[model samples]
Target: MTTEEKVARRKLSLLELAKDLQNVSKACKVMGYSRQQFYEIRRNYQTFGSEGLVDKLPGPRGPHPNRVSEEIETAILEHSLAFPTHGPVRVAQELALRGIQVSSTGVRGVWGRHDLLTRHERLLRLERAMREQKIELTEEQVRHLERFSPEFRERHIEVHHTGELVAVDTFFVGTLKGVGKVYLQSVIDCFSRYAWGRLYTSKLPITAVHVLNNDVLPFFEAHNAKVSTVLSDNGREFCGRKDQHPYELFLQLEEIEHRTTKVRRPQSNGFVERLHRTLLDEHFRIQGRTKWYEALEEMQQDLNDYLVTYNTKRPHQGRNMKGSTPYAVFKKGLPKATKKEPRKTAENTA
Candidate 1:
């Protein structure tokens, strides 16, 4: 019925024909098989029964000798996970940089076996890895995923603890009739989403420094937490020559690292961007329509009151907030090392 079965029947008939004709040469001629093949088939039947009759393709069985080793394949896969946007040739080159000798063909072979031939398939693999918490997402990976997949735009920046990273931005509130244009210097703790903002007539380097010095640092100081990093866009207010810029000098004085977002990539500083959107939607739009403001001081007062309620009372449903107030998360997320115990003196120990 099957091809193997048919082949086995034909071989069995050859043996019968040889026995009936009483001549091996005549049976081989009628069966269209060489004398050597007939002898080999007969021997296989005697030794392995009908199974040996099934045609096994002539080649090395199992893995090909030319295929990459398991360790190299694993390296390729891990590299792919980290940078899914890289093509086979790029991957090969990257591996080469690491002193791993792998050809572009080898990389393609690995991708093919894993069904990661397309960029989308590779990105989907990355998404799964992120969801499973197997790997931390880098900014570049985040950018790639956000560009390729719309659903991935909901992914939040990963912050482990409070004061780990802080995002700062300058926002234009609106023009005050007598005061010209009003800008807001906004600072937010990326971990807790606790925010601070100040009203200014202009977005200058000093305005950015003033908010951090007067508002952000004091709050962190009260909690015994130190900011290690400040992220901002490449605005003149936030970024300039470290030796000359007021904001840069202030950051240097405070011993905090300043990191600017990539040019033209606003989402690189996404936490601050989201904060600006929230302020616009909840505070500015509502306050603008409902109440008439006479001066910047009046606007600042209302903003301060709103901020108190926002930080202490309003529940946030953000990534790890879990319906907790920013104030609560801020205090709870503080690193244990920050709350240092006083060194025991001889008198105290006694």
Candidate 2:
């Protein structure tokens, strides 16, 4: 960039930093600029755009009045472009060999005005000059260059209808009043927010498969719906590389696709996560501690009553299904996935 371009970039950067920090004093302190200068640059940029940053040299419009001749200045720029690896000192020495007699400081000043001081900056200019050429990049290089991006924002998925996707996950509900520590395996519809879960004493793969088979599948059958995909995290129960996982085998036999969230990416399974939080606040935290329930069967009965209230009576606050219950929204959904006749899933005691 030219000196004018550098000044404009500095001014623009300061303004952006100030807006982001939301404090002019702190922006100035970090950017190493005085408040007065910041205000001047901001005012000019607002009034006249980036062109205002150019130094309004008050003298002649042509080259330096008495300094290096036009011929010598042209020689300096040509030599610098021809040999970008050389710096100001080397350029001056090259000019001396030709009897041009220009100091290193003079050559540096010329280079600064033209913005050709750094080899990286010059190479960028050369690349711009060759913009019409086709450039192919390797896959690894493309992946490695992604660090230059600002940040990764979550992409929102559009919900066409209920049963298009189901997200399942296991949440660790605190120990019941009389029962030991337990878990709840929940499967929730992404569209209607309809949910179903079962209390389990163990967090095994079989527990997850039973939740899907007994609760989730029956619910889908009642509405004549098919789950296009079941999303989950990479827990041992819902995910594995081999076919030994009972949950994976169950999904396969049921003709439903199983998808796991990327490693370290829990947001991909956010629907089930939100459902877990809601249940924690409304169901488990409120009723489980009111009276000690020694038997897991008693807790299961209490959970079923709450699930009815949640699906049929509670008014959901979702934007898509306003003033409607989960059961109401679910009744209106149509199945999208292909349904196949049920078959027994393979069982192996490894």
Candidate 3:
């Protein structure tokens, strides 16, 4: 097929899925095209028909096409080294501030040629160059190397029952007059998604341990179940390599395994992170009066009420527990316990 026809067919398929799903984000994710790219493709198809769908190759027609100068290229590399976290847009802005003329697209082209697609990738190359003495280092890059913590950084898993895995995360829930800055520590079973949370003034390891000790463990223990593993980020509160990391110690004492998300990969803990976002929208935002809370006790009470309704009443739309509340699913997964008393029988069988 001609390039135009091939491109047209692809665009038609994307448009059809977009129509079917009625969700730009989901459709774009499935088709591997960004939302902006999809919208542009749709617009071109609607306006110019199939002819507009043809992909255009880059570069000038003349022998002397526009090219980045050696000076400009050097500047780009130096800026990248200095601000390893900056992307093409920010780099272009920085260049403009330094009286250099370059479009974001041009900066991106330079980055692509260098294979510096992300800040993390740039940081790696910058470090290797410094080690090999390949490139001269700037003061800013040197300082950043000293300050950056690389450890600050998965999804397919089937959970058949509660207590197989639980995710715990701390969320900033704004400040209160008596409580100062408030934080919510949430623990959710990966299977049933039954959640428990407590508000606290500190994010210390003890606070997290408290949530597990007083809340999660007791509830599960009452049902004769035990938490197999807990998933969280590398935050010191969740876990660390230190010998005295209280959170890690607590998990060990409870015979629960601790698993952390990969560095820079929060989507690995998608379940808990999504819960935080939903709480931010529904509970925190709605109850926030003038962005300040009245009292800690009252706030905690409100949150507890919400949690009760969420666990016992609200039907979950999660993949496994469709049309079932979290509590309903949790009970089903509970290990069957034999009756304490044997059945009584009459002795007069004669």
CA lDDT of each prediction against the hidden true structure: 0.89, 0.80, 0.82
Decide which is better by lDDT, 1 or 2. 1
Per-residue lDDT, model 1, residue 350, is 61
TM value for model 2:
0.55
In model 3, residue pairs whose N, Cα or C atoms come closer than 3 Å (at least 3 residues apart or on different chains), thus clashing, are 153-262, 153-263, 153-264
User: Which candidate, 1 or 2, would have the higher TM-score against the true structure?
Assistant: 1
Model 2 lDDT tens row, 30-101: 988999998998898888887776667787788665567779889988787677778888989998999888
Question: Tens digits of per-residue lDDT for model 1 on 1-350?
Answer: 99878988999999889999999999999999999999999998888898777777787778878999999999999999999999999999999999999999999999999999999999999998878886778999988997878577545678898999999999999998887899999999999999999999999998898898789887887788889899999899988889999888778877789998767878778888888888888899999999988799999999999899889999987777899999999999998855544432235656
Q: 180, model 1: CA deviation in Å?
A: 1.5
TM-score of each: 0.57, 0.55, 0.51
- Model 3: lDDT equals 0.82
Which residue runs of candidate 1 sit more than 4 Å off their true CA positions?
1-156, 337-350
lDDT (Cα) of model 2: 0.80
Task: Output the better candidate (1/3) by lDDT.
Answer: 1
lDDT of candidate 3 over 1-350, digit per residue (tens): 98767777887888899999999889989988899999899898888887778777677654335667878978998899888898888999999999999988878777888898778889998888778876776998876664464532133556877789999988888767665898899999988989999999889998998888888987987777778899999987987764588898777766678898777777778888878887777787887854445778778888898889889999889877888999999999875663432211223322
Q: Pick the candidate with the highest lDDT.
A: 1
